[model samples]
Target chain A: MTIHHHPGKERIDAVRAFNRFYTRQIGLLEEGLLKSDFSLTEARVLYELAHRDGLTATDLGRDLGLDAGYLSRLLKKFEERDLVERATIEADARRSSIALTKAGRQAFAPLNQGSHEQVATLLERLSAAEQDRLVRAMQTVQRLLGGSAEPKIPYMLRSLQVGDIGWIIHRQGLLYAQEYGWDETYEALVAEILGAFVKSFDPKWEHSWIAEREGEVVGSVFVVHQSDAVAKLRLLYVEPSARGLGIGRRLVEECIGFARTKGYRTLTLWTNDVLTSARRIYEAAGFKLTDEERHHSFGKDLVGQNWNLEL
Target chain B: MTIHHHPGKERIDAVRAFNRFYTRQIGLLEEGLLKSDFSLTEARVLYELAHRDGLTATDLGRDLGLDAGYLSRLLKKFEERDLVERATIEADARRSSIALTKAGRQAFAPLNQGSHEQVATLLERLSAAEQDRLVRAMQTVQRLLGGSAEPKIPYMLRSLQVGDIGWIIHRQGLLYAQEYGWDETYEALVAEILGAFVKSFDPKWEHSWIAEREGEVVGSVFVVHQSDAVAKLRLLYVEPSARGLGIGRRLVEECIGFARTKGYRTLTLWTNDVLTSARRIYEAAGFKLTDEERHHSFGKDLVGQNWNLEL
Candidate 1:
């Protein structure tokens, strides 16, 4: 975050290494992508033409990041081969709209399936969970570097995505360690609870909400069924980086709404006194402190509190 | 698969759409990657120099897909800024090895960390499971497109990786559907077995083996602890494309070895009579039929057989 500070050489090397590995990994240097006759650039231009009905040379160049002169030449070649046809735009006669001919569509089809099969070939080897992880990681990479010009944390509440679970566990584990001087015992506690929750998960009686900011998950909470008439609030946390965004408040509201709709007569929760931020959220959401006890856990002797909200 | 047949134009559009989505997702088209001053190409040149020692200007040009003249100019600029030093090769006067100066590394460090943090920011939000998925998917994309000139499915076995479970299940599901018209019941059966295995996974007593060729998983088998002295072999499968490579036999052999080393007295499995290739593999692995019964399952009335190997 400090732009003026000189980062270690190792950090730069790691990034460079990742770039090289990924470039090689994605076959950007391949002589032919998907074993087709087309170069990567040609494949890209063809892909654009195949997807959209009309495009000028400028649009193709812009979308494919091609040079203006180079794109015009390539399009001219396509026209010569009868793979593309150009017509004057009705609104602006000066501009020409490029369209793929039947032959062009036919030429592009195998390449499309080839690419699909290529991805599928890789995907088939992975478990479904693995596939989700790979996609989400890609999303992460994209969201991070993409100058998305929006809030990194959009403050939106959504259904739990695949990696959100482990992320919360890891973050909660480390955040508690750093902030409260708690130990692995806290992470273990979170894991054990999540494991059981996943094992006997009843979607109707149990619901989890993930609060995301600009595609990144910042906070989360779960409402698990204790009985038909009662529910327990569990693992309410917000990343310190994403704090003060009202994400904590929104997560608690989601839990309350879910509990009401699920017909629970009462809601309760257990938290440590050191977790004042979470407590504040609960209190704001109508949860009243019911009891407090001193407990030794997570390598800390602390006051534990239970809170309840009547539905 | 047939080159003569015309692939639907929509298929090509889909692939193009994916490419556009992914490029934008990775922020490739950003004015500056990760909001640093260096262009993507400039950063790439720096990366090549940072990673490899004693590379020449020619080497950098070739490795980075840069024009020789443009690269030479970039190197000249780096020299002017005291960011790089070049030494003439003793054996070849025409070539000189380029090395990054302390200043060059300093210039690159923040950019490197910026990129790393960018990715880390994305990674921190995913659950560990989700992280695994994201990474594995990236690997899949890499392996598929990265022209690995070797066997499509080598007759070699490896320890199971993250996605092998889902891949096997999916392959088995689709293969059975195509080959024998089995329904979703078969997929459910496989999921149930794998789910139970994951729920109580023990690396010491329970082991899983995955067979891969040129970075794609082809076959897999799991040996789970039924008791301290008993092991059960479950979910043995081979990809149809990877069949006839003795992968199934090798997977069975791996299971047997794991069972023996783990000190299991016997190993057992359940399968249908319709699976002739698997039955043959089991028979070759010294498993003998212990029981057989006719049953209605997976939309077919079939004979289910129990096989066991006494270790």
Candidate 2:
């Protein structure tokens, strides 16, 4: 007897077909992309230099998500081509900043334009509503796929930056409205969260980032000053779509790094029992639950809790 | 001022992060999987060989989703390693069958086992319920990502193969139940479809295949007898997750191929107007909408349509 095959075979088959199509669609053809004048790796380095005016080798490696050794070789190729110039930063000799030469920018311009046109052409096929649906679908996919706890620091943390907050509020409001018929409370809570951050915003003492994937924001976090003795971790939120990818943990870690530089003695956050994942991240980052209270604020009873960690 | 960014930045960031994590999780380590005793290309050839024992080089290229030229090089490497042995079929000397050598099988066994273990381990981390959820989430992702139209020749049409039929019924039933609240009707329809196929199955005149991906069955289709002068296309269903990848078109094409080989002068299919996408595929494959009738059999308004194509 056949048991319930929840996802079923047809879907799996469709996925296989899609995997083939997408790989064909977006995966660059090495021969086409790599001209006689430039190797694939060399062209990538040039592209990097063209986009980022000044970056250290380490920074390049981080931004491009390339292995240091692989990036080092690619850099060497660019150096030989006279397309890239590397210089040590005067303040930190260990950091070597790379910039594109005149020729490098010239070579990069056409290639970049071609890529831009390709993307435009693909988007052109879709209507505005279809594009929106596609983008939303991609957002859902990214969240589902990216939310898992995967190692690799920069991209993981970057996935939780500022714009993600807007998406979180938008998605939460929509989902809550649909699922629980609680639009007013959901919107009110989101407004409160947004207001709290805007009121506390101080460029000198706080910074925010919204993480995006496939053109949709999925997560966000902020670092804000508390008393002179502490820095508060604020507005850390990751959408349910991006829940499993350890995006929450990475966001918390960013707050910790910012707090250390800001010279705070401790970091603190407010949450609730329902936010178990967020609480887990705080605890993993050496925070402990310090305060609790019963509350009813979004038309539902909730246990409000605070967590704190010494820097 | 930033307008709502097209392709939300947060989603892309999350996707990039997940790509990094998933690549790692799946053991896509360049050093290990790419640099084993077999070259990357050779390993790919071996994998193709293990999965399809008698595919020609061109067929192998199609199935492995590799470029013909790249696949040629890989085939050469596999030959050098004595992992693949190629021989011309007596029936068609121009075509060659590729079979794995003893060494190839030996090497493939460990690789396949390791790959299975990796996927199993990831699945093990979730509860059975969570595993089901993950699979459903994956289906959603595959549907969103894979739904695109691309063209290719249709080959063997396999209909209602065991696994494929099972998935089709399971998924169709669930979708009908969830979306239309017609569980009993859906169940009844699926049973009728299955029962018809089983009673009429004839391998000598018909063919079927269960499409498998990532070690799971995903789809199925079949072509069967009509009159002595015509063939009927039956059991053409794709899982919701696999829609948009042109599987339906492929399935239809397979039917055409079988009908041609069996000397049928025409092919026909029956479907509902609600399935516009499937109708589009039929029309694209040179089938013409011939008749339509309105009916309410399953407690809902339905338009029954018949499409036909002359060989």
TM-scores, chain B, all models: 0.63, 0.49
**RMSD (CA, angstroms), candidate 1:** 8.9
The DockQ value obtained for model 1 is 0.09
Runs of candidate 1 with Cα error greater than 4 angstroms are: A1-225, A233-252, A270-280, A289-306, B1-51, B54-144, B148-264, B269-283, B292-306
lDDT (Cα, 0-100) at A216 in candidate 1: 66
Which of the numbered candidates is closest to the native, going by highest lDDT? 1
Candidate 1 local lDDT, B123-170, one digit each (tens): 555444334434554554444334443344355777754444445555
Give the per-residue Cα lDDT of candidate 2 at A63: 49
Cα TM-score per model:
0.55, 0.42
The stretch of ten residues in a row with the least summed lDDT in candidate 1 chain B is: B1-10
Q: For model 2, how does the per-residue alpha-carbon lDDT over A1-311 read when each residue is reduced to its tens digit?
A: 11122343444444333333334333433335545466655655666677676688887676455689988887787778777788878999787889988877877888765544444444445444344545555544344334444323323334222223334444555545554454235443553444355444566677776666444455778777778778777667665545666677877887888888887888888876876667888888999889999987656777889888888
Candidate 1 is graded, for docking, as incorrect
Tens-digit lDDT track of model 1 for A176-295: 877888765566556556645654568999998888766667788988999999999999988765666678888888889999998999999999888888888888889999999999
